[model samples]
Target: MRNINEGENESKRSPQSIVREVIQGGQSVMSADARADARFVESESVIAENILSILCVPLIIKERIAGAIYVDHRQARHLFSQKDLNFLEAFADQAAIAIENARLYEELEEARTRLSLENESLRREVLVEKHLDSVVGQSEAVAKIQFSIRKAASGNSTVLLRGESGSGKGLVARIIHNVSPRRNGPFIKFNCAALPETLAESELFGHEKGAFTGADRRKLGRFELANNGTIFLDEIGKVTLAIQAKLLRVVEDKEFERVGGTQTIKTDVKIIAATNLDIERAIDQGTFREDLYYRLNIIPLVMPPLRDRKDDIPLLAEHFIRKICRDLGIETKHLEPGVLDLFVRYNWPGNIRELEATLHRAIVMSNGDTITRNDFYGLFGDIVPASPDAGPVPMPGSLLNPVIGKMDITSDIYDEVMSSVDRQLIERALESSGGRIREAARRLGLAR
Candidate 1:
């Protein structure tokens, strides 16, 4: 129970000489009466701290002595016996095991951290690859869009993408972000049409706690989150004038206050906006701000409708087939010859999205190894194929045309319109075929 007040000075006072010897030799050393021993009696530690009885034992780790433990009695002679030395050796062995276990645990933790970082890097790489691959075309129209994307990526100018819904406008935006200098920063997207006017403001500019009724906590807005990066505003035409004014500030000055907060937050973000609406028409109608349009239209990029790039239909269809099949955990399916020809002939008013949906339906409805032209019947409902007599092909129209008004029509409207047309055509064919569906299908150039 003797305490060593000068243990801190032992390393500096030449006690390391004896301790190092014991550690190197992997053995114990004892001086039952140090004053009676000439070896350490003259040492500064032994003389200054008063003569002592000492015991030292080596601390071995993995068959090598890393260090040693030394115990001494300040006032007693022969206080430590052979039994005490044996007990200290057993404690040293336990201490070595504890140290080794701690070292191993730290190494394991370091390895785990490295693995986690590697996995995250790999995941981001895969996402970028998947996004790039999904672009899926080599047509002139596609090549032109790719060229514009590359040009846009070279700068941080505000880009306004004008395209029909489902024409992969968002994908183009992401390509710009991934290739730009701000690629390492966050790419935040918010659909202006997804939230109500009240909530849209809160979402775009964030809100302070108690900003309004049911506003329980403060929130960070998309602009704030996308600082030093890119923020994609989908359906930007849907925002109200109030929100437009606030958004214009961000586009022009890169600063805005939260919904109810007085603090002005500055952001360094690139704006990439997409809208199916015609900015010209909207500006004329006073629904959209002219100044805002000018600021966002710095680089206007139009995404071509799928119908214009009919040559890419086969490539896109096959890509979607493989991707959707893999996602559904089903065997890969092929398209029958002439099916792709029919796809090319049909003016996919819904653009790329409609084509993908059509293919998804064909794959889901058909159990065969190949999707034939007949599979489109359950989806497109007797829409006539490539025939000289069926009817003239539906031309791709603009969203500003009052008759078309909106370019992005839903699947339900598409189905309803096609069904009505199909019903009239079927009635005429039935009259010509004595009310036989088989014969009607034949007259309409549809698959039976």
Candidate 2:
């Protein structure tokens, strides 16, 4: 019951009329010496394969014939018998059932795959909405920031965020990365002020085995990890001049060598640096290099401090409340009538960071649904000592006099005060150097 040339030559295929007749009638088709039979006298299959005998059985499923099984015997006379025909009918019924089951299984698998794709798409949409909503407040200040974030996200330029400590600079940096074309890539971050000089270098550029004492194995650096993505260097100004020199090469050339290794590895990365320190002052004092500053400051973005954007305090308070409640699995809570007013009046020395911390504490300590002024003051009252005549909020350089709002001073007086400050600094350096002029100059980081 076989035809060797069935698929090899389309011209040798059985007549379509006979096959269709068997399928439509749900019956069998049999022939002995089909060439001599009048039914297939002019058929191409008979002449091509030199058919001597043929048989076909209809494949039926649920009382309907869906297909047929065909057999041809070219080397024998009267090869097919009634017994053979009956056996072929049973085989065709089993084959039809198997084919239907396989078709049903394929359909089920396709439906499952389609449903899984839809679920994943919905999950991503929800995540993107929640993430963007994290930046609360609709005030002009926040709106401008959103605009800047969107603009920065469209490009691969180096961005330098400048503001007071705890002013949401890190949050803004993350927003920029998420909205950028490199959103799918890694978003690596490093706090330059958190580690010592030795650890800072190794962590930034990675280290090979035996790079230093206790160095057991090779390590990959943040830049390497962030390859083809973005790296956020928080408190960038705190990094030493030595590390800054190596970092400068990455910004310009996009390459670096691992510590204690000679291999010059290359990477494609975008750098976003943030700092609370006065970079210009650091450059003047020789703690930060000017060339490196320019390279990082190509697209400078100044994050507004909490003091300047007090209008958004109420919105921020509610956002934090919702966020804290959701995280702690607690019911949503509200602020008392006077609590928000007091929040706006008191200067936030710690900026948004301090505000979120205060709200988290209030949510935890409060006994009722509404946070009272007492709950808010219990945490921040003594720390700030709220009063109308209180001094301005302390910032990165608040140790010195207020640069923006100071009393009038004549030119001579200003010069005299600066000279006095400079003299005191120089004398202290000389004393520390044991009165050696060259030693004092070196300590002051002066070439002369």
Candidate 3:
């Protein structure tokens, strides 16, 4: 029963009321006539509300009184009984359980959210480390390139990577995107040279259903897939003039329509274009548009050739050796004494790519744990000459003159002459170095 004067009743039923007594005593209180009961007769709320009957029971959970349930009736005395109090107490027990369960569920949800955020942070850390490790080098050129990568990642401007083939331009492009603000977004890569001219436009901008002869379904383009992220266009210099014009509109306006579609799709993608071909020369020949070149050249990064950074050869070799060995499921191998010296002296025409391929071949051909100089013999075409003290080695052309027309017709003359020259050269170096193999390799300019 509710009090007619609730505010005044609350003030009157403080420390010495029926509900308060049940809570403190942890027991039930049933009054047949609350207005005349000795315990509530002096209470102002009981007399003012003319309460005839009252029942109050403490809600107990684990021997603790959480609260009290109070019921009363003014029209009739002895309205509530022991049976009603018993039912309410049982219901309070289930209510308390439900309250505790709801609290636990909230905590579990909070913990799940926290753990998900931490996992995402850890994933980004591992991704950055993997990309940085791929750019293996210790030269000043490499240091400069790393600095440029950081600068390029700081903004949303288009980037142009210029270098020869196999010089790690693609690797650099990925690193830039991984460390940028768009790191959490998608990174889409496209090779312009891989697609034929007839299909280049549709491949780049996608096509609507039935747009062409075999276009059966609608397709999403790389730029659409790379929205709010990055798109790396490899061999951008090879794109034809017709595609270049469409590419210019996307770069400048960030909008394009799919092939044979009227709706213009917009994208917020960062463009990173790379090419081994000289773009300036392509523009001179009217093959590549100059405006598109200028748009992509906002942040240019040049990857140095492996030949120019010779000091990094040993490091690159060690990296590729360990990587290739692990990939092939073989025991780790080390390069022999003279192998690094041989690498430093020769010119790598294919840059870092050739070095890696050569090492892979050497490791596969080698039968032991150590990769010897012989494993790399004839891999770099002609051999380097001996040290200055060992005297000049004859050229293959000059050596062929003395044995001309003297061999049998059935003999492999070229192989026989070159083998003879190699044998003599090794013999002379061995004699000059007092028969010490290590010293002989040094005198032959094959060892440090």
Estimate every model's Cα lDDT from 0 to 1.
0.81, 0.81, 0.80
- Better candidate by TM-score, 2 or 3: 3
Model 2 lDDT tens row, 211-315: 989876566777877787889999999999889999999999999998998999998888999999999999999999999999999888888888889999998
Per-residue CA lDDT of model 3 for 238-259, tens digit only, reads: 9988899999999999999989
User: Per-prediction RMSD in angstroms?
Assistant: 16.5, 20.3, 17.9
Clashing pairs in 2: none
Structural similarity to truth (TM-score) of each candidate: 0.58, 0.57, 0.60
Residue-level lDDT of model 1, residues 342-401, one tens digit each, is: 677778889988987888988998866877766777544546645858586575565236
Report the error of model 2 at residue 149, Å. 0.9
Candidates ranked by TM-score: 3, 1, 2
Top TM-score hit: 3
lDDT of 2: 0.81
Report the poorest 10 consecutive residues by lDDT, candidate 2. Answer: 121-130
Local distance difference test, candidate 1: 0.81
